[model samples]
Target chain A: MSIIIDQLNYTYSPGTAYEKQALKDISLVIEDGEFIGLIGHTGSGKSTLIQHLNGLVKATGGSVYYNGADIYDADYNLKELRTKVGLVFQYPEHQLFETTVLKDVQFGPKNLSLTPLEVDLRAYGALKQVGIPDDLIDASPFELSGGQKRRVAIAGVLAMEPEVLILDEPTAGLDPKGRDEILDQIAKIHDERHITVILVSHSMEDVAKYVGRIIVMDHGRAVFDGAPKKVFSHYKELEGIGLAAPQVTYAVNALRERGILVKTDATTVQEAKAAVLAVWKG
Target chain B: MIRDITIGQYYPADSVLHRLDPRVKLTGTLVYIVSLFLVKNLWGYLIAALALAAVIRASKVPFGYIVKGLKAVVILLLFTVCFNLFLTSGTPVFEWKFIRITKEGLYLAFSMAVRLTLLILGSSLMTFTTTPNELTDGMESLLSPLKKLHVPVHEVAMMMSIALRFIPILLEETDKIMKAQQARGADFESGGIIKRAKAMIPILIPLFISAFRRAGDLAMAMEARCYRGGAGRTKMKPLHYHGRDAGAWITMAMFVAVIVVSRRF
Candidate 1:
């Protein structure tokens, strides 16, 4: 099922002195099997926007429709919506509380009111999909390394079999190898499961390498939403909001500035390399 | 959802009360609370209420803000009022079956409720006018005499300050953890008391773990700066009483005199 947000607005602490407009008049549609990157600096309301998808935060004004039904309606089942649109928070591992990794992964499906056998089966499948070996499944999640714990957390969400998975800053504070492993796992999940993936990150390079579309947020507004190259082309505007394009976009732009003929639309290292090679071959 | 707490929250203002020394405010609050309890009749309570109103206005903190702190003690206030209203024995003003309404009970309940409300307002006013740092300094200075008995006055003050500082941070952490658990379908609402308590297991375990983790990090941070039990440390800005503090003390004394005189009639 697809998700549509129309003219959404959210204000924190409404009617109080500390009131702040976090999301303003945002409208967007996410189709099935789309890998979308939501990019913004901290406090830009990207997280707030996504929270409305699962009915976590109600919009002060406007509506969010999931599968053409308003999830905020009284008749709608919020628990089912949350299960279908999984949100893995910034530090998912902090939510891991069960004694064993298997139990932690089973926590989501168990909440779905599924039978014991199906819950464990889904947990096993999610663990295997996240590449957690069977030997470590029965051990305490706290005993795992940071990356392993993160995967277990992700597996916990995956066990619910969500059609759309939203991960906020999934690779934050990880080493280079851990970052790649997470990015690869997310890509694999999207490729194999055909679930719409929404990745929220401030890192341009990571998103540029994976996501098909990018939505740039600045000061509670959707400033840009397009392909990675199209979004990177507005590097100056992005930099104004304390965000930057991928390093390859800068390299390509610098080459063009020096009167060297090359494509300035490159958003990845490989794309920049190919552009430079094409110029040299000509 | 835990963000509505107003206790220990400071409101920044540039009024006379805000400018007064923290020591004076703390002592003044103590005097005010004592005077509230000293009140025996309507006249005494009126005096205390007037004094409280004047101070709240001078402090420039909205009365509504101070009243908001009462939300935390609402259940306690209700219990006290109800117990005094029903259980205090005296001449029956009205009678119905097992329930007896006495004139004395009515007066006692009204006085107790007013006193409790004033007490909360006076104390909350002090916290509202004083920042946590200033409060800590005032507390340390006020309790320094206890050091003669080998008490760890400075350590106690530091611990109080740290505890105050962590309230907001931990509240924010709790909110985030709650949201995370909710996303995992851990239903914190819509369950019986026992079932709801069971639901909290998922949240409480992680909360405790993170709390310990944060405490460890804070300890390391303190040690990195060579912090050692608050010994041999001097204040960057030492607390000193000014003319305003003396004026405040006199005002508090006058208010106490009012309470004493009003108790007579």
Candidate 2:
């Protein structure tokens, strides 16, 4: 299944003093099983754009297609579209209201009218996927630490077995260690399930390390959409919008500036390592 | 989609009413509401309507915008009109099978409808001109005399302002949580009343939790900065009455006088 957005436009509070055009005439396509990174500055329409994929937001103009079917059609089933395109919001732990971690995760599958046995199985599978401990399954989600609660929230969406998973700033407010753990687990989920993943983050390092494709949004327009290496290579343009490339991109550029030739397109540490080793062999 | 509310929304403008002191606007709104209740005749309503029109004009807020607020109060308006028309007893102006329309009843209903419409418009006008901060500041100063009765007036005002500030924040939070739950296949629409109320559980629980957490954090942050009671606290922008405020006060008094005089006839 694929998702396609064509010439989308969205304006907030039209005809009022607070009116703002959040998304411009933007278009993009998402293929199945592709791990994509969506990055933007605050209010750059990243949140608004992701909201469109699940029909949480309707575009004022243009159209959205899911699996080659127009999602805006009068007869389109939006509830099903929402389930198929699961969205894990920022600080999603705030949405966890169930008594137990297992119950919270099961909420989604149960909403699908699944049999009790299937609900429990999918919930268990999701909990395991997010690496929730067996002992904590019956524990109140509210009692868990911040990171644990966040994982349960993600499990809540994952239990639905969505075809596409979109996470908005999943690592926000988490420490570096927690951030790495969540992203790595998401990568594993994408690999194991072969489901499409859209990771929305403001952090350059987080997206560069995991996502194969990066879409850069600026002032309601997608400024760059390409592989991490190609997108990060325009570090100058990225820096102009209060964003910078990953550390390795800057380090490689710095190396080139200091009269040592290195592949400046390297966006991650491993790629920088390979480039430096190649230069060292010379 | 919850952004359609127009009541209690401030309209930014540099008109006479907006430039006047918020205390004047507050007092004007209170007196206007009281006068609305006091008036008993068509002449009184006409005077009140004129005053409202003048205030709206001076407020620089579009008349249509002020009228939009009446949408929420439409049912109440109709209820008031119907009760005064059919239930009121007097000389019959029109008669149908079981329906009786009396001359006095018709007059009462007309006056009642006008009174209600004016009440809503007059009140919303103040909100359109005065922002919440200015309002709280005005209320705090106005209620300062009540501090002698151990009312914790300053703290109450602070709490009130904070609550006002949290409305939009909590609304945005509600939107986020609702969408998060919806993404989990939670159906909020297409349900019976009981089912719909149950659907709200997910949104309400998280909203209350987050609101309390925010309150706790705010209390700590205030305490961290050595915030004590209101005794020694000074304002960043103190409320002061300008010439425009005095003029507004005189105009409000005159508006009340005219309505009160017209009520006597």
Candidate 3:
């Protein structure tokens, strides 16, 4: 395991009138090269729990260990830790302050104190990884479309060359096509790079298509953590907490409920289609 | 993170103050602020405070919420009281090395604190009863006469209304950005002043860009709707001055006169 969170707790505005316990005793281990999907409703502590992995949020109680070392140890350099576990915030295009997209992408690698030639090489490589065009590299990030700006933001983080990558609601506010494009890009990155990817999303379909393991949270606690098929099997419990399994899984379950033979584990439309075809042919 | 701001908090109520015309409420607030400054004596201060309390009770806003609003400025209030107490030289009630707390000074500090407290409470009363849209409409009507001075009164009011409308949206966006940065291991707390400030760059930069993008989109939308520079613009709901509004103005005039006369004592 590359990241291990043991009984992590987090509270916002800890001593003030606005104090809120956003996370409660969240414990999870993320192994290297695994794609994990984190899903929860608003204010469910999904964001709070993930932030502990990179040292952005210090645990109120318990500890987070990164590669066998406590991240909160006084001797650990946080900036270095951040570089090792890159975070790409939602709508990162907003953080693009450089005059050119290339310069903005170079920011993280430059923070690493790399040679100028190395910085440019890493920046170019990062931009390519996120599928940004060469001609657009020198153009201002502000001039890009909403979806393009999002890609540029992702590239900025990739330039840091972290061992693990975390993204929060990366597809939010995007049209269906835009959402699919970004998700496809991220999936490709995970497949090729073999870096541990933690994706926080509310959409079941996206998680079903991309992540291998699904972690479900409710009211600041991790309630379920398993493969998509195993997690979706607890349909009633998920529905009680205002969450639903992927549409195909729900449809398959409905068919089974109606006394029609179907596999309830079918998560994607393609899988459901294949299962139905097999039953008809039989 | 930005949602914690409590500015322009509106308390929903069905009281007479809530039913009153927003223009009347806006004018009453202006008159009330002027009266607070005019009063210099204990009796005048007490009367103003009493009037504010009456308004607060009539508005039916929770006393706890009003007190919470005051808590934000408690430090400033204390500084004002201390500055007046030790700096004003009069018949010394208590003295220390190079410092004297006088009877007049004590009275001044007490009155000053009461004045500021009542001033904030009174203004909050207006906000609590009046929605931002209504307040902006009232402001536009009130400033309409400034058109003779070539001032774009309607434009200013429209800008204020738009700004007010975006407060919640901006707050929500800020929350999203904060979560996004936090997920990436961008530590926001437990850093030195400079380190903390540098941490804000990731959040702030994204917020500003999004805000600008929103502004651009709003401008285009407005243009598509044929919105000009307030020229020949007609309102959907025109403000009507009624008998009750006139009565409110008269009552406010009397209230101001009472405070001014009480100051002469």
Model 1, A204-268: lDDT tens per residue?
98899999999999889999999999999999999999999999899999999999999899887
**CAPRI-style grade of the A/B interface in model 3:** incorrect
Error of 2 at A199 (Å): 0.7
Per-residue CA lDDT of model 2 for A1-282, tens digit only, reads: 799999999999776667899999999999999999999999999999999999999899999999999999999999999989999998999999988899989999999999999999999999999999999999999999999999999999999999999999999999999999999999999999999999999988898999999999999999999999889989999999989899889899999999999878888788899999999998
Put down candidate 3 lDDT per residue, B62-163, tens digits, no spaces. Answer: 676676667668899999999999988889999889889999899889988998888888887888788877888899888989999999998898898788
Q: Any idea how many clashes model 3 has?
A: 2
Tens digit per residue, CA lDDT, model 1, B5-78:
76777887889999899889988888888778888889998888888899899988877767778888999999
Evaluate model 2 with DockQ and give the value.
0.72
Off by over 4 Å in 1: A15-17, B94-97
Better of 2 and 3 by TM-score: 2
TM-score of each: 0.95, 0.94, 0.72
Q: Where is the poorest 10-residue window by lDDT in model 1 chain B?
A: B1-10
Q: Write the per-residue lDDT of candidate 3 for residues A118-202, one digit (tens) a residue.
A: 9999899989988899999999888999899899889888888888988888998999999999999999999988899999987
State which candidate, 1 or 3, has the greater TM-score: 1
lDDT of 3: 0.84
Q: Which residue runs of candidate 2 sit more than 4 Å off their true CA positions?
A: B62-113
